[model samples]
Target chain A: MTAQIIPSRTAAEAALAEIFASAKAGLPGSGAVEKLREESFAAFARGGLPHRRIESWHYTDLRALMREALPIAPAPTRERRAALRKAAAALPANSLVLVDGVFAAELSGKLPEGVKVTSLSAALAEDRPGILESLAAAWAEADDAIVSLNAALMRDGVVIDVAPGASLAAPLHIVYASVAEKPAARFSRSLVKVGAGACLRLNEMSLGAGGRAGQTNNALIVDVGEGAEVGHTLSLTDTRPGSLRLETFLVRVAARAKFDSFALVTGGGLMRRQIFKLFAGPDAKGTLRGVSLLRGREHADTTLFVRHAATGCEGRQAFRYILDEESTGVFQGKVVVEPGAQKTDGKMLAKAIMLSDAATMNSRPELEIFADDVICGHGATCGGLNADQLFYLETRGLPPPEAEALLLEAFANELIDDIGHADLVAAYRAEVAAWLAARARSETRSVA
Target chain B: MLEIKNLNVAIGGRRILNDLDLKVAAGEVAAIMGPNGSGKSTLAYVIAGKEDYEVLSGEVLLDGENVLELSPDERAAKGLFLAFQYPVEIPGVATMTFLKAALNAQRKQRGEEELSIPEFMKRVKKAGDMLDIKPEMLRRALNVGFSGGEKKRMDIMQMALLEPRFAILDETDSGLDIDAVRIVADGVNALRSRQRGFLVITHYPRLLEHIVPDTVHVMAGGRIVRSGGKELASELERTGYREYAEEAA
Candidate 1:
């Protein structure tokens, strides 16, 4: 008999095994859903965690970054709920609040007319019509290990459905607040559907309390109906140093539909936000824009994949990163035009500004076109601030730090000003200013 | 008052300015006319505290204060300004905002309160009108996509807003037409006061017709080879720098 060799399991794998062994019996769903959970976990087990060997995850090796998985978060208590409500109160009115990955109906304000919102767990328990179908649609196209793990362990989220031809009078806000007393993890998934000819504005924010280390895995799936208009924005900030966050967004745009997405990441120790957008019908338009401000030892990665599947579709992706101290930022964007997708127009750009010698940025922008008549291009640049520009601002009477902050703000304002909403632009600007202030304070302290 | 005594500057290990000596008293305007490679722009940049040039010897004094140890912004706070020959185009930063920030920063360094938004608007509007700068131009990015005349007008507007005690105009008339040059010269003439001084560096003496200088110096081989009164500008305009160039050689 030939000798057999076995590879040792990593810490993440060992933690996954333990979680699966203890939580399998109590997990939700049956039949197809149960089978899906089992199959997804099995797939994750077979592959372990993504490392440098995976081309898509070359810059962010999760297996090495995430040493061990924290235990699943416990149910939210009265005190935690109170704290969450306080935090939610500071956000815009008519917002949905999720505490510890569970939807809090009491905390959520009144909903708009012609809109329906329900808890994902309650829908799963009642076997709600179209719930399984909607979840299965995204599952069919997902091939990522982190997304697979989220599918296997998702506990609860919110389900939103907008009536056909209806236009929302006000924007909808979703606040995800993590209030864990100990080191823990929470997984949540949401589904949103905008009806044909309808208009919807959705905003999301993720906040974590300070202190202990915590992990959050959240996923969102959006379906834009024919001729529908959807505007979505996400803000992830105020994350603690020990926090680990992974957020994934999957969007499908139909014929003549328009979808715009903007995400701002300013905090978090380790984070990876991915967006997969599919242009399913002709004449569709989609845009993805983001800004990341990282300092300290924080590591943030944004990966985007936009596929043009129909003729005459257009897509654009732009992202900027400002890294300081020992932080690292990564941007990987790919635009693919399938065969027969004639007249497809796509462009992608990634730019980074490194403020310190120890700061690092990895940018990869790729374009793959299988069609002859398509126009697709991508470009990436990473460098420090321009010396001439800096000197110009300095001669205008600005100190070094102030000049740098102004340049950084101008760099990011290119995208923020394009948001077209006054309140949203103001909010984003305030966040950028706060980040710059903190950076200046830290620099002063170090110098002292 | 601004003074450069026995100044020697080297850039990239190559001597650019050799034993240059000049002085401009308060309320006086000095013109430096020279050929293409005479380092007129180098003198302007070195005075503004640009980092590229190395001062081998001598000192640059502003009101008896050695400015070599200060940064560019510090020099600005000490009332020194340079109107770039080719004004930089900074996208996404509105001209009005840049003006406000610059004004406030200078005020802050001098231990003064920041200007209110309305006050700032009033000041900019007054200066903008004098320089024929439209409101739309102020709303757009600073010098981005601006015409050559418009950029020089914007520079004059900045000079008016800051009201620096000492200003250096480096090739300020390089790209402007006759009408644009008149408007720019008028703007500069409006800001000229007994407490302020100016160093007007130009390739041609045509601009001197509007903002005539009190003294004219011919620069060649990196030094001021000849010094004369305002009549020298007209003389140099007609005769060129051939005589001074040969004398320096």
Candidate 2:
């Protein structure tokens, strides 16, 4: 008789098994959706949590980093929702709120004409046509264990749809806030569909209450229709020291469509934000940009996979990171041009500035081109702040910290200044200023 | 107003200046002319307190106060300035914002009230006009994409705005046309006062024709090999630095 060898389960795998067993029966969807969930969970179980063996996850070893997983978070109470509403009162009227992964109708206000917003769970419960299909369309293409885990465990999210040939006057802001007192996990997924000849502006934000080790696993899938224009901005701010966040974005741009995205990651304990952008049709254009500010033992990773599958398409990416204290920043970007993708142009650049002796940065920019007549290039640079520049500012009568702040602002402003929206630029500049002020205050505290 | 006594400086473990002694009195412009590799720039950097240069032994006194113990900004607050040979370009910091910040920082350090926006703007406009610097250039990033002449003019404009008590011009005339040099010299002359001192470092005597230094020093090897009036610049231009180089060797 041959002995059968069964691999032992890791803590993450065991935790997933327990969560899936408890939530599967109560989860939305049946038939195809149910089968997709089962298959995705089985796939996740087969591979377990992604570790160093996976090339994409090499820099971020989730198996070792995420040693323990917290239990699923419960829905926020009425009082909690009220407090969240009060706190988020500063947001624009055309905004939606997601508390602890569940879409809060009480917190959401009226939307403009020609725009429809609904909860994912509600759509699944009512068996809305094409809802399950849209959710399952990108499941197999994600090709990451963390994404598969999100697909298996995602309970609630929002579905935003813009009518054909329509345009929204104001940006649609979606705020995700975690208000759990104890350590917990929240899984959410959002799907956005911009119709043909339509235009939409989508803004997303993630925030966590201080003093708790919370886990947030979020995913977004965006489909840009033919000749549509979509602008998306994501901001992650004020996360707790023990928070772990993993976000994935799957974007597909159609013929003559335009997709513009910018993400600012300023606060987190452990974060890995991955973006998969595919130019699926001819003459499509995409610009993906990001800036990350890390400090105090934080580890942040931004990985991108830009694929040009059609001819006459162009893609550009620029990412910059500012790391301080003992923090670690990572950037892994790949531009791939498939066969027959002639006249494709792709460019990528990643730069980092280390502010302390213990700070570390890892950047890898790669290009894989199979087409004969295509242009693709990438560059990465990692270095400390220029000593001569600092000296120049110092000699002009500014103190050391103030001079450093000015230089760092200048470094980040190159990207921030290109943002087309004036309001968004101002908002991001304020956030940067706040972060620098906080850093200066912390330095003073440590010195004292 | 500015004095360097027995100054010894080494950079990267190599002696660049040895027992250098010089002084610039109030209202006087002292010019240092030297050949390549003569440690002229090192003296300017040491006076400004650049971090990499090791000051083994020195007493840099400004108005009877030892300035060697101060940081670069502290030295600036005490009214000292150094115009760089190669001005550093900061890509996103606007020149106007930098000027305002610098002027306000110095004023605050000296316990003076900050200038109002209109007042600061008027001052900058006057200084810009004097230096022939367009207002649009002031709105651009500091030194980024500036031509050689523009960069030199910008340095002179900064000096005009700051109005320091002691100024050191390190090769400010290196990358300039005749017109630019004249404009820069005119800007410096406009700021000249009895309480202010100037130390001009150059390789050629062409700049001395415009600034008209009271004292000229020929530096070779590490220390001053010759010191005389403005006539010394013309003499060096006629005979070249060969004799001074041989004498120092």
Q: Of the candidates shown, which would achieve the greatest TM-score relative to the real structure? A: 1
Q: lDDT tens string, model 1, B76-185?
A: 99999999998888887888878998999999998999999998999999999999999999999989999999999999899999999999999999999999999999
Model 1 vs. true fold: TM: 0.97
TM-score of each: 0.97, 0.96
Residue pairs with backbone atoms closer than 3 Å in model 2 (clashes): none
Model 1 stretches astray by more than 4 angstroms: A1-6, A209-212, B247-249
Give the per-residue lDDT digits (tens) of candidate 2, residues B1-249.
899999999999999998999989999999999999899999999999899999999899999898999999999999999999999999989898899989999999999999999999999999999999998999999999999989989988999889999999999999799998999999988988888999999999999999999999999998998899999999988999998788777
Candidate 2 residue spans exceeding 4 A from truth: A1-6, A207-212
Write down the worst ten-residue block by lDDT for model 2 chain B.
Answer: B240-249
| Quality of candidate 1 docking, DockQ | 0.79
A57-170: candidate 1 lDDT, tens digit per residue: 899999889988988888776787676667777777768877778888888899988789998887877888888888777876667888889888888899999988989967
Worst 10 residues of 2 chain A by lDDT: A205-214
What is every candidate's alpha-carbon RMSD to the true fold?
Answer: 1.8, 2.1
Query: What DockQ score does model 2 reach against the true complex?
Result: 0.81
Error of 2 at B164 (Å): 0.7
Model 1 chain A lDDT-worst window of ten: A205-214
